[model samples]
Target: MSVWAAVLALIIERVWGYPDRVYRILSHPVVWMGWVIGKGDETFNKPDETSFETGRLVGAVCLGAFLALVLVVTQPVARLFSALPGGWVFEAAVASSFLAQKSLGEAVARVAAALREGPIEAAREAVSHIVGRDTAGLDEAEISRAAIETLAENASDGVVAPLFYLVLFGLPGIAVYKAINTADSMIGHTSDRYRAFGWAAAKLDDVANFIPARLTALLIALAARWIPGAVPGGALRTARRDSIRHASPNAGWPEAALAGALGFGLGGPRAYKGEVLDLPAMGDGRRELDADDIDRALTLYRRLLDVLLGATVACAVVVWVV
Candidate 1:
């Protein structure tokens, strides 16, 4: 069943993330998706060639077709796998590629480690790999905050959202979510070239993530109860009070929760593309964060994954029995 497949996929991802040598050989599922999306951009998204409305219309149609194509391929494959004995395990391995538990955690853990022992530039460089914001001028606190924010937001985007879809619709569901999320990342931007051409991808990705974002906030709040020095109530309270005030519809939920749980202030005035964005601060806690805060965040994230895995197993049992 799909529920059990979700459990196996989580365990597999936690134990062994996509290996580097394998990535060298196969690149990644997202990379392949990115290639197709790039082709779409190149063929039709001509800024000077097409009008704004034309671009929007074309993007919408292309997005619809891309999603349709994903479902067409993945749905049949899922059915074929279900027909074979122990095939769900093979499907689980395929599904594991869609999860980012180890990858995101390892990346954030490296940032924390670099911040603790390495030079300021090392810390900045590590943080830059995860966040899109300008890291050149970041101080210790800003760098630490950026790292934690990325871990928190990606806990939802990279892990929770994909798993959510996997549980609901098996391999096909997860494939569709990843395709949309990848399309959004590749082309969904506010730049002059992307603003109109990527409208559908941007909006659809938001719609897909809406529930999972809040669910991640709730899960973080739950996991915070078990993490030493984390405040579950504060996480819940801040998420409720400040999540909507964030610049993005979904990112604020988990960011505010993590900030409150760790008693650190985050998300206030960051530079992007050399332009300063005076974003609203998430939690009203201590503004001066250090490497220790990043460590606490990593611990919380690990604990959250444990909680998520246990819940997935429980759901699998329920689905099997029913």
Candidate 2:
């Protein structure tokens, strides 16, 4: 039943992609989580006064509280769904709302479309919405690189990690993972403001995403075989050699895999909040990325999503029969 629910959720999300009206009316689960994280930060994460040890404690306490709240809410909801007729469909819808597959594709596609049809400024605006790097001074190649990198990194965080948890531990699994991920996104950083206070959130997110990130890399490598001009063997080799080069323990896997897939360099130094981060490049391929490259990355992303969906269906069938 859980597997069927996952399948239904994937289908629903692909078809509807979380309508704007729905979002306007109900906000989103991620938004709800963000509000809680913000309040926690405001209350406990005082940058000037809070020491590293205190910040770590506060962060752990806040994360523990949020996890407790998620379990409390989702456990009963799962039970309620089990009680009612055809209630798994409702569970499926709730689960689907957590995924960003179609939305991610749409967002990346917008950057490509803007780059193709409009000025560099337009494409920059579109890419800015998805990436955290400084976009104000990016040229066309830089803009395309940023968009493609965001697409790869978020594919693991926004889609595969949630689905991985869903398959492993059902609704509560995904709920808990999303809460942690939301915390990481809201507060996780290296700035003095978040360095200590966001430690637990950031570390927990890394732990949760470790396996899924590697799985995403492998899947992206497999997807490269189907995309023209992409070399699967090179993707796998590059991922193995360069995944650890990025600052993050998890994000680099997918980003490196995608860089290799597209035969381009990514994850070089970039600015954030006016400070330049001297990050290492992921691939030794070409550095001259363009709009067409963005389109190719999207094709790989969509095909990877398809592969994940097909795998989900297979798992669901096995669970149903066994």
TM for every model, in the order presented, reads 0.98, 0.97
Give candidate 1 misplaced runs (Cα > 4 Å): none
In model 1, the clashing pairs are none
lDDT by residue (tens digit), candidate 1, 201-267: 9999999999999999999999998998889999999999999899789989999999889888988
TM-score result, candidate 1:
0.98
lDDT (C-alpha, whole model) for all candidates? 0.92, 0.90
Model 2 stretches astray by more than 4 angstroms: none
lDDT of 2 by residue, 1-322 (tens): 6778888888898888888998999999889989988999988888789789998888899889989999999999999998989998988999998899999989999998998998888998999999998998998888988999999999999899998988787789899999999999988887889998899999999999999999999999888878988988877888899988878999999999998888999988899989898999989988888888888999999889888888999999988888
C-alpha RMSD for every candidate: 1.0, 1.1
Candidate 2 vs. true structure, TM-score: 0.97
